[model samples]
Target: MSQHQILNPADHAQLRIHTEAGAEFGDNVMASLAMPAEFREVQAHYPIVFRRDAETGKLAALALFGFEAGENLFLNGSTWEARYRPMAHAVQPFLIGRAAEEGAPPQVHVDMGHARVSATGEGMRVFDDTGTATPYLEAVANMLGDLDYSWHESDAFFTALETYELVEPFSLEVTLDNGSVQTLVGFQTIHEERLSALDGDALAALMAEGHLARIYMVLASLAQFGGLVARKNRRIALG
Candidate 1:
Protein backbone atom coordinates (compact mmCIF):
# COMPACT_ATOMS: atom_id res chain seq x y z
CA MET A 1 0.00 0.00 0.00
CA SER A 2 2.97 2.30 -0.41
CA GLN A 3 2.60 5.10 -2.89
CA HIS A 4 6.09 6.04 -3.95
CA GLN A 5 6.79 8.88 -6.36
CA ILE A 6 9.63 11.12 -7.43
CA LEU A 7 9.49 14.21 -5.23
CA ASN A 8 8.94 17.52 -6.96
CA PRO A 9 8.25 20.96 -5.62
CA ALA A 10 5.14 21.41 -7.71
CA ASP A 11 3.51 18.11 -6.85
CA HIS A 12 4.43 18.07 -3.17
CA ALA A 13 4.45 21.78 -2.40
CA GLN A 14 1.80 21.50 0.25
CA LEU A 15 3.11 18.25 1.69
CA ARG A 16 4.24 18.19 5.31
CA ILE A 17 6.07 15.52 7.23
CA HIS A 18 5.31 14.59 10.84
CA THR A 19 8.57 14.76 12.77
CA GLU A 20 7.49 13.22 16.06
CA ALA A 21 8.89 9.86 17.20
CA GLY A 22 6.19 7.27 17.85
CA ALA A 23 5.03 3.76 16.99
CA GLU A 24 2.25 5.12 14.82
CA PHE A 25 4.95 6.28 12.41
CA GLY A 26 6.38 2.72 12.22
CA ASP A 27 9.01 3.33 14.93
CA ASN A 28 8.04 0.26 16.98
CA VAL A 29 10.87 -2.00 15.84
CA MET A 30 13.34 -4.21 17.65
CA ALA A 31 16.25 -3.25 15.39
CA SER A 32 17.40 -0.81 12.75
CA LEU A 33 20.10 -1.08 10.10
CA ALA A 34 23.48 0.31 11.16
CA MET A 35 26.42 1.49 9.08
CA PRO A 36 30.10 1.54 9.98
CA ALA A 37 30.40 5.32 9.83
CA GLU A 38 27.71 5.70 12.45
CA PHE A 39 28.84 2.81 14.66
CA ARG A 40 30.49 5.14 17.17
CA GLU A 41 27.28 7.05 17.79
CA VAL A 42 25.14 3.92 17.54
CA GLN A 43 27.34 1.95 19.94
CA ALA A 44 26.70 4.48 22.66
CA HIS A 45 22.95 3.75 22.57
CA TYR A 46 22.29 0.34 21.05
CA PRO A 47 24.00 -3.00 20.65
CA ILE A 48 25.40 -3.52 17.18
CA VAL A 49 24.87 -6.93 15.61
CA PHE A 50 24.85 -8.53 12.19
CA ARG A 51 22.07 -10.32 10.32
CA ARG A 52 22.24 -12.14 7.00
CA ASP A 53 19.72 -11.87 4.24
CA ALA A 54 18.10 -15.27 3.77
CA GLU A 55 17.86 -14.95 -0.01
CA THR A 56 21.16 -13.19 -0.80
CA GLY A 57 23.23 -14.44 2.11
CA LYS A 58 24.55 -10.89 2.49
CA LEU A 59 25.49 -9.69 5.95
CA ALA A 60 24.13 -6.37 7.21
CA ALA A 61 24.62 -4.65 10.55
CA LEU A 62 21.74 -3.88 12.89
CA ALA A 63 21.30 -1.76 16.02
CA LEU A 64 19.22 -3.65 18.55
CA PHE A 65 16.48 -1.75 20.38
CA GLY A 66 14.55 -4.52 22.11
CA PHE A 67 14.46 -8.29 22.71
CA GLU A 68 11.36 -8.95 20.62
CA ALA A 69 9.82 -7.90 17.36
CA GLY A 70 7.80 -4.66 17.25
CA GLU A 71 9.00 -3.87 20.76
CA ASN A 72 11.26 -0.81 20.86
CA LEU A 73 12.66 -0.28 24.35
CA PHE A 74 13.79 3.19 23.26
CA LEU A 75 10.25 4.25 22.49
CA ASN A 76 8.49 5.96 25.41
CA GLY A 77 5.14 7.05 24.07
CA SER A 78 5.79 9.78 21.45
CA THR A 79 9.44 10.17 22.40
CA TRP A 80 12.42 7.97 21.58
CA GLU A 81 14.54 7.78 24.73
CA ALA A 82 17.87 7.79 22.99
CA ARG A 83 20.45 10.46 22.18
CA TYR A 84 20.71 9.16 18.62
CA ARG A 85 18.60 7.18 16.19
CA PRO A 86 20.00 5.15 13.30
CA MET A 87 19.82 6.75 9.88
CA ALA A 88 17.61 3.88 8.70
CA HIS A 89 14.95 5.01 11.17
CA ALA A 90 15.59 8.76 10.99
CA VAL A 91 15.09 8.93 7.20
CA GLN A 92 11.59 7.46 7.32
CA PRO A 93 9.16 8.04 4.40
CA PHE A 94 12.00 9.27 2.18
CA LEU A 95 14.44 7.30 0.04
CA ILE A 96 16.99 7.75 -2.71
CA GLY A 97 15.92 6.68 -6.17
CA ARG A 98 17.41 6.52 -9.65
CA ALA A 99 15.90 7.28 -13.02
CA ALA A 100 15.67 4.74 -15.88
CA GLU A 101 18.53 6.34 -17.82
CA GLU A 102 22.10 5.23 -17.32
CA GLY A 103 24.38 7.29 -15.05
CA ALA A 104 21.53 9.42 -13.84
CA PRO A 105 21.95 11.19 -10.52
CA PRO A 106 19.99 9.96 -7.57
CA GLN A 107 16.62 11.55 -6.88
CA VAL A 108 14.60 11.87 -3.71
CA HIS A 109 11.49 9.72 -3.57
CA VAL A 110 8.70 10.04 -1.05
CA ASP A 111 6.23 7.46 0.16
CA MET A 112 2.91 9.24 0.01
CA GLY A 113 1.21 6.52 2.00
CA HIS A 114 3.65 6.80 4.88
CA ALA A 115 2.20 7.84 8.21
CA ARG A 116 4.51 10.85 8.35
CA VAL A 117 3.37 12.20 5.01
CA SER A 118 0.64 14.74 5.71
CA ALA A 119 -1.20 17.48 3.81
CA THR A 120 -3.12 18.97 6.73
CA GLY A 121 -0.46 21.62 7.47
CA GLU A 122 0.15 20.16 10.88
CA GLY A 123 3.80 19.20 10.39
CA MET A 124 7.07 20.44 8.91
CA ARG A 125 6.67 21.80 5.42
CA VAL A 126 8.55 20.26 2.54
CA PHE A 127 8.44 23.38 0.39
CA ASP A 128 7.91 27.10 0.80
CA ASP A 129 5.28 29.20 -0.94
CA THR A 130 7.82 30.19 -3.61
CA GLY A 131 8.27 26.52 -4.59
CA THR A 132 11.70 26.22 -3.03
CA ALA A 133 12.98 23.50 -0.77
CA THR A 134 12.54 24.20 2.93
CA PRO A 135 15.25 23.87 5.56
CA TYR A 136 13.73 20.61 6.72
CA LEU A 137 13.86 19.22 3.20
CA GLU A 138 17.48 20.33 2.83
CA ALA A 139 18.44 18.58 6.04
CA VAL A 140 16.61 15.44 4.92
CA ALA A 141 18.44 15.59 1.60
CA ASN A 142 21.79 15.75 3.39
CA MET A 143 20.84 12.81 5.57
CA LEU A 144 19.73 10.88 2.49
CA GLY A 145 23.06 11.59 0.83
CA ASP A 146 24.98 10.40 3.88
CA LEU A 147 22.81 7.29 4.12
CA ASP A 148 23.36 6.47 0.44
CA TYR A 149 27.12 6.74 0.77
CA SER A 150 27.29 4.86 4.07
CA TRP A 151 25.19 2.05 2.65
CA HIS A 152 27.86 1.24 0.07
CA GLU A 153 30.59 1.63 2.68
CA SER A 154 28.83 -0.98 4.81
CA ASP A 155 29.18 -3.51 2.00
CA ALA A 156 32.93 -3.07 1.99
CA PHE A 157 33.09 -3.37 5.79
CA PHE A 158 31.08 -6.61 5.75
CA THR A 159 33.24 -7.99 2.97
CA ALA A 160 36.33 -7.26 5.02
CA LEU A 161 34.82 -9.04 8.03
CA GLU A 162 34.11 -12.08 5.90
CA THR A 163 37.62 -12.07 4.49
CA TYR A 164 39.13 -11.93 7.97
CA GLU A 165 36.70 -14.60 9.26
CA LEU A 166 35.84 -12.31 12.15
CA VAL A 167 32.11 -12.91 12.31
CA GLU A 168 30.33 -15.64 14.35
CA PRO A 169 26.78 -16.41 15.39
CA PHE A 170 25.61 -14.87 18.65
CA SER A 171 22.74 -15.63 21.04
CA LEU A 172 21.58 -14.18 24.34
CA GLU A 173 19.15 -15.14 27.08
CA VAL A 174 17.77 -12.38 29.28
CA THR A 175 15.95 -12.96 32.57
CA LEU A 176 13.83 -10.07 33.79
CA ASP A 177 13.19 -9.05 37.41
CA ASN A 178 9.76 -10.70 37.18
CA GLY A 179 11.33 -14.10 36.31
CA SER A 180 10.36 -14.05 32.63
CA VAL A 181 13.05 -15.16 30.20
CA GLN A 182 13.64 -13.88 26.65
CA THR A 183 16.03 -15.46 24.21
CA LEU A 184 17.52 -13.56 21.27
CA VAL A 185 18.65 -15.62 18.30
CA GLY A 186 19.76 -15.54 14.66
CA PHE A 187 22.17 -12.61 15.06
CA GLN A 188 25.94 -12.48 14.60
CA THR A 189 28.81 -10.66 16.27
CA ILE A 190 32.55 -10.29 15.94
CA HIS A 191 34.65 -13.30 17.00
CA GLU A 192 37.19 -11.89 19.41
CA GLU A 193 39.27 -15.03 19.45
CA ARG A 194 39.64 -15.12 15.70
CA LEU A 195 40.25 -11.43 15.57
CA SER A 196 43.11 -11.80 18.05
CA ALA A 197 44.53 -14.67 16.07
CA LEU A 198 45.02 -12.55 12.98
CA ASP A 199 48.56 -11.69 11.97
CA GLY A 200 49.95 -8.14 12.07
CA ASP A 201 49.52 -7.83 8.29
CA ALA A 202 45.83 -8.65 8.48
CA LEU A 203 45.37 -6.23 11.33
CA ALA A 204 47.18 -3.56 9.33
CA ALA A 205 44.91 -4.17 6.36
CA LEU A 206 41.83 -3.73 8.52
CA MET A 207 43.24 -0.58 10.04
CA ALA A 208 44.28 0.79 6.64
CA GLU A 209 40.73 0.37 5.43
CA GLY A 210 39.27 1.86 8.63
CA HIS A 211 37.42 -1.27 9.69
CA LEU A 212 39.36 -1.95 12.86
CA ALA A 213 37.86 0.92 14.85
CA ARG A 214 34.38 0.02 13.73
CA ILE A 215 34.97 -3.59 14.74
CA TYR A 216 35.97 -2.45 18.21
CA MET A 217 32.93 -0.18 18.29
CA VAL A 218 30.73 -3.14 17.58
CA LEU A 219 32.34 -5.00 20.41
CA ALA A 220 31.91 -2.07 22.75
CA SER A 221 28.24 -1.86 21.79
CA LEU A 222 27.54 -5.30 23.25
CA ALA A 223 27.76 -3.71 26.68
CA GLN A 224 24.66 -1.68 25.89
CA PHE A 225 22.59 -4.85 26.18
CA GLY A 226 22.55 -4.39 29.94
CA GLY A 227 21.11 -0.89 29.56
CA LEU A 228 18.51 -2.21 27.13
CA VAL A 229 17.49 -4.86 29.64
CA ALA A 230 17.19 -2.25 32.37
CA ARG A 231 14.88 -0.22 30.15
CA LYS A 232 12.77 -3.29 29.47
CA ASN A 233 12.53 -4.12 33.17
CA ARG A 234 11.57 -0.52 33.94
CA ARG A 235 8.85 -0.62 31.32
CA ILE A 236 7.52 -3.89 32.70
CA ALA A 237 7.51 -2.49 36.23
CA LEU A 238 5.61 0.63 35.14
CA GLY A 239 2.88 -1.56 33.69
Candidate 2:
Protein backbone atom coordinates (compact mmCIF):
# COMPACT_ATOMS: atom_id res chain seq x y z
CA MET A 1 0.00 0.00 0.00
CA SER A 2 1.07 3.56 -0.63
CA GLN A 3 2.05 5.55 2.48
CA HIS A 4 0.80 8.94 1.39
CA GLN A 5 1.13 11.99 3.59
CA ILE A 6 0.49 15.68 3.23
CA LEU A 7 3.57 17.30 1.71
CA ASN A 8 4.81 19.70 4.32
CA PRO A 9 8.30 21.13 4.23
CA ALA A 10 8.69 20.60 7.96
CA ASP A 11 8.11 16.87 7.70
CA HIS A 12 9.74 16.42 4.32
CA ALA A 13 12.69 18.75 4.32
CA GLN A 14 14.97 15.81 3.55
CA LEU A 15 12.73 14.30 0.87
CA ARG A 16 14.38 13.67 -2.46
CA ILE A 17 12.74 12.69 -5.71
CA HIS A 18 14.28 10.58 -8.44
CA THR A 19 14.09 11.98 -11.97
CA GLU A 20 15.21 8.92 -13.89
CA ALA A 21 13.10 7.51 -16.72
CA GLY A 22 12.89 3.73 -16.93
CA ALA A 23 10.82 0.66 -16.17
CA GLU A 24 12.13 0.91 -12.61
CA PHE A 25 10.44 4.32 -12.45
CA GLY A 26 7.10 2.58 -13.16
CA ASP A 27 6.31 4.09 -16.59
CA ASN A 28 5.50 0.72 -18.15
CA VAL A 29 2.03 1.02 -19.60
CA MET A 30 0.16 0.80 -22.88
CA ALA A 31 -1.45 4.16 -22.27
CA SER A 32 -1.73 7.12 -19.92
CA LEU A 33 -4.49 9.65 -19.44
CA ALA A 34 -4.40 12.58 -21.86
CA MET A 35 -6.03 15.97 -21.73
CA PRO A 36 -7.48 17.85 -24.65
CA ALA A 37 -5.18 20.74 -23.80
CA GLU A 38 -2.21 18.38 -24.26
CA PHE A 39 -3.27 16.98 -27.64
CA ARG A 40 -0.82 19.10 -29.58
CA GLU A 41 2.15 17.75 -27.63
CA VAL A 42 0.84 14.22 -27.24
CA GLN A 43 -0.05 13.89 -30.91
CA ALA A 44 3.51 14.54 -31.91
CA HIS A 45 4.77 11.36 -30.20
CA TYR A 46 1.94 9.05 -29.25
CA PRO A 47 -1.38 7.96 -30.68
CA ILE A 48 -4.27 9.51 -28.81
CA VAL A 49 -7.23 7.24 -28.18
CA PHE A 50 -10.29 7.11 -25.97
CA ARG A 51 -11.70 4.34 -23.82
CA ARG A 52 -14.69 3.91 -21.62
CA ASP A 53 -14.07 4.17 -17.92
CA ALA A 54 -14.74 0.77 -16.39
CA GLU A 55 -16.70 2.40 -13.57
CA THR A 56 -18.17 5.58 -15.02
CA GLY A 57 -18.49 4.31 -18.60
CA LYS A 58 -17.60 7.80 -19.79
CA LEU A 59 -15.16 8.37 -22.62
CA ALA A 60 -11.59 8.95 -21.44
CA ALA A 61 -8.71 10.05 -23.64
CA LEU A 62 -5.26 8.46 -23.41
CA ALA A 63 -1.83 8.60 -25.06
CA LEU A 64 -1.25 5.13 -26.48
CA PHE A 65 2.13 3.51 -25.97
CA GLY A 66 1.96 -0.02 -27.36
CA PHE A 67 -0.37 -2.63 -28.82
CA GLU A 68 -0.56 -4.55 -25.57
CA ALA A 69 -0.55 -3.97 -21.87
CA GLY A 70 2.58 -3.12 -19.83
CA GLU A 71 4.52 -2.13 -22.94
CA ASN A 72 5.66 1.46 -23.34
CA LEU A 73 7.28 2.07 -26.71
CA PHE A 74 9.04 5.27 -25.69
CA LEU A 75 11.26 3.44 -23.19
CA ASN A 76 14.74 2.74 -24.61
CA GLY A 77 17.56 1.86 -22.25
CA SER A 78 17.07 4.14 -19.21
CA THR A 79 15.60 7.07 -21.08
CA TRP A 80 12.16 7.99 -22.40
CA GLU A 81 12.67 8.51 -26.15
CA ALA A 82 10.14 11.21 -26.78
CA ARG A 83 10.06 14.95 -27.26
CA TYR A 84 7.07 15.30 -24.93
CA ARG A 85 6.16 13.13 -21.98
CA PRO A 86 2.58 13.45 -20.86
CA MET A 87 2.17 15.34 -17.60
CA ALA A 88 0.16 12.43 -16.27
CA HIS A 89 3.27 10.31 -16.77
CA ALA A 90 5.75 12.99 -15.69
CA VAL A 91 4.08 13.61 -12.30
CA GLN A 92 4.71 10.59 -10.17
CA PRO A 93 4.72 9.85 -6.42
CA PHE A 94 2.93 13.14 -5.81
CA LEU A 95 -0.87 13.30 -6.01
CA ILE A 96 -3.44 16.04 -5.61
CA GLY A 97 -5.66 15.69 -2.57
CA ARG A 98 -9.03 17.25 -2.12
CA ALA A 99 -9.51 19.78 0.63
CA ALA A 100 -11.32 18.65 3.76
CA GLU A 101 -13.66 21.66 3.53
CA GLU A 102 -15.45 22.76 0.40
CA GLY A 103 -13.96 25.72 -1.52
CA ALA A 104 -10.54 25.11 0.01
CA PRO A 105 -7.51 24.71 -2.21
CA PRO A 106 -6.27 21.25 -3.05
CA GLN A 107 -3.32 19.87 -1.10
CA VAL A 108 -0.29 18.04 -2.44
CA HIS A 109 0.47 14.61 -1.03
CA VAL A 110 3.57 12.48 -1.53
CA ASP A 111 3.74 8.71 -1.50
CA MET A 112 6.51 7.82 0.89
CA GLY A 113 6.77 4.29 -0.51
CA HIS A 114 7.03 5.36 -4.14
CA ALA A 115 10.17 4.08 -5.84
CA ARG A 116 10.94 7.58 -7.09
CA VAL A 117 11.45 8.84 -3.53
CA SER A 118 14.54 8.35 -1.37
CA ALA A 119 15.03 9.50 2.19
CA THR A 120 18.82 9.17 2.11
CA GLY A 121 19.22 12.14 -0.25
CA GLU A 122 20.01 10.10 -3.34
CA GLY A 123 17.79 12.13 -5.63
CA MET A 124 16.79 15.78 -6.15
CA ARG A 125 15.84 17.48 -2.92
CA VAL A 126 12.28 18.61 -2.58
CA PHE A 127 13.15 21.24 -0.02
CA ASP A 128 16.29 22.83 1.24
CA ASP A 129 17.45 22.73 4.87
CA THR A 130 15.57 25.96 5.42
CA GLY A 131 12.27 24.25 4.51
CA THR A 132 11.90 26.15 1.28
CA ALA A 133 10.78 24.56 -1.98
CA THR A 134 13.58 23.61 -4.31
CA PRO A 135 13.56 24.02 -8.07
CA TYR A 136 12.49 20.41 -8.53
CA LEU A 137 9.60 20.79 -6.13
CA GLU A 138 8.53 23.99 -7.82
CA ALA A 139 8.46 22.24 -11.19
CA VAL A 140 6.39 19.41 -9.79
CA ALA A 141 3.95 21.90 -8.31
CA ASN A 142 3.63 23.64 -11.66
CA MET A 143 3.05 20.34 -13.43
CA LEU A 144 0.37 19.44 -10.92
CA GLY A 145 -1.35 22.75 -11.49
CA ASP A 146 -1.41 22.14 -15.25
CA LEU A 147 -2.70 18.61 -14.70
CA ASP A 148 -5.56 19.87 -12.52
CA TYR A 149 -6.59 22.40 -15.12
CA SER A 150 -6.30 19.91 -17.96
CA TRP A 151 -8.47 17.39 -16.17
CA HIS A 152 -11.39 19.80 -16.18
CA GLU A 153 -10.80 20.93 -19.74
CA SER A 154 -10.48 17.38 -21.05
CA ASP A 155 -13.60 16.28 -19.18
CA ALA A 156 -15.61 19.01 -20.81
CA PHE A 157 -14.34 17.96 -24.24
CA PHE A 158 -15.34 14.36 -23.66
CA THR A 159 -18.78 15.46 -22.51
CA ALA A 160 -19.22 17.38 -25.72
CA LEU A 161 -18.17 14.36 -27.80
CA GLU A 162 -20.67 12.19 -25.96
CA THR A 163 -23.52 14.67 -26.41
CA TYR A 164 -22.94 14.71 -30.15
CA GLU A 165 -22.43 10.92 -30.45
CA LEU A 166 -19.00 11.51 -31.88
CA VAL A 167 -17.21 8.90 -29.81
CA GLU A 168 -17.27 5.25 -30.86
CA PRO A 169 -15.43 1.98 -30.40
CA PHE A 170 -12.30 1.37 -32.46
CA SER A 171 -10.44 -1.76 -33.51
CA LEU A 172 -7.04 -2.35 -35.03
CA GLU A 173 -5.54 -5.39 -36.74
CA VAL A 174 -1.91 -5.27 -37.63
CA THR A 175 0.19 -7.88 -39.44
CA LEU A 176 3.77 -7.70 -38.33
CA ASP A 177 6.63 -8.29 -40.74
CA ASN A 178 7.01 -11.81 -39.35
CA GLY A 179 3.43 -12.57 -40.35
CA SER A 180 2.07 -12.59 -36.80
CA VAL A 181 -1.10 -10.65 -36.17
CA GLN A 182 -1.69 -8.10 -33.43
CA THR A 183 -5.33 -7.40 -32.84
CA LEU A 184 -6.13 -4.41 -30.63
CA VAL A 185 -9.59 -3.92 -29.27
CA GLY A 186 -11.65 -2.36 -26.49
CA PHE A 187 -10.56 1.15 -27.39
CA GLN A 188 -12.55 4.16 -28.58
CA THR A 189 -11.85 6.96 -30.98
CA ILE A 190 -13.56 9.90 -32.58
CA HIS A 191 -16.22 8.59 -34.98
CA GLU A 192 -15.70 10.33 -38.26
CA GLU A 193 -19.08 9.23 -39.58
CA ARG A 194 -20.94 10.69 -36.64
CA LEU A 195 -18.65 13.66 -36.43
CA SER A 196 -19.44 14.44 -40.04
CA ALA A 197 -23.13 14.11 -39.28
CA LEU A 198 -23.02 17.00 -36.83
CA ASP A 199 -25.28 19.88 -37.85
CA GLY A 200 -23.85 23.34 -38.46
CA ASP A 201 -25.07 24.43 -35.02
CA ALA A 202 -23.48 21.46 -33.28
CA LEU A 203 -20.26 22.00 -35.22
CA ALA A 204 -20.25 25.66 -34.16
CA ALA A 205 -20.71 24.67 -30.52
CA LEU A 206 -17.81 22.22 -30.67
CA MET A 207 -15.61 24.77 -32.39
CA ALA A 208 -16.52 27.44 -29.84
CA GLU A 209 -15.63 25.04 -27.02
CA GLY A 210 -12.20 24.39 -28.63
CA HIS A 211 -12.95 20.70 -29.01
CA LEU A 212 -12.65 20.62 -32.80
CA ALA A 213 -8.89 20.89 -32.92
CA ARG A 214 -8.30 18.32 -30.22
CA ILE A 215 -10.58 15.85 -31.95
CA TYR A 216 -8.61 16.12 -35.16
CA MET A 217 -5.37 15.75 -33.21
CA VAL A 218 -6.59 12.47 -31.84
CA LEU A 219 -7.40 11.28 -35.33
CA ALA A 220 -4.07 12.45 -36.67
CA SER A 221 -2.08 10.87 -33.87
CA LEU A 222 -3.09 7.42 -35.05
CA ALA A 223 -0.35 7.69 -37.64
CA GLN A 224 2.15 7.11 -34.83
CA PHE A 225 0.86 3.56 -34.44
CA GLY A 226 3.20 2.41 -37.17
CA GLY A 227 6.14 3.55 -35.06
CA LEU A 228 4.70 1.89 -31.96
CA VAL A 229 4.34 -1.40 -33.83
CA ALA A 230 7.90 -1.09 -35.08
CA ARG A 231 9.09 -0.61 -31.53
CA LYS A 232 7.32 -3.78 -30.51
CA ASN A 233 8.91 -5.59 -33.40
CA ARG A 234 12.36 -4.46 -32.31
CA ARG A 235 11.78 -5.72 -28.80
CA ILE A 236 10.70 -9.08 -30.11
CA ALA A 237 13.62 -9.26 -32.51
CA LEU A 238 16.16 -8.41 -29.80
CA GLY A 239 14.74 -11.06 -27.49
Regions more than 4 Å wrong, model 2: none
Q: TM-score for all predictions?
A: 0.98, 0.96
Query: Evaluated with lDDT, which candidate comes out highest?
Result: 1
Worst 10 residues of 2 by lDDT: 114-123
> How does model 1 fare in lDDT?
0.94
RMSD of each: 0.8, 1.2
lDDT of 2 by residue, 1-239 (tens): 59999999888978888888878778788888888899999999999988897998888788988888888888886888898988888898998888789899988889888888876668899999889899888999999999998987777888898888888788999888778999889998889998898889999888998989888999999999988899888888887
Q: Please report, as a residue range, the 10-residue window in candidate 1 with the lowest summed lDDT.
A: 114-123
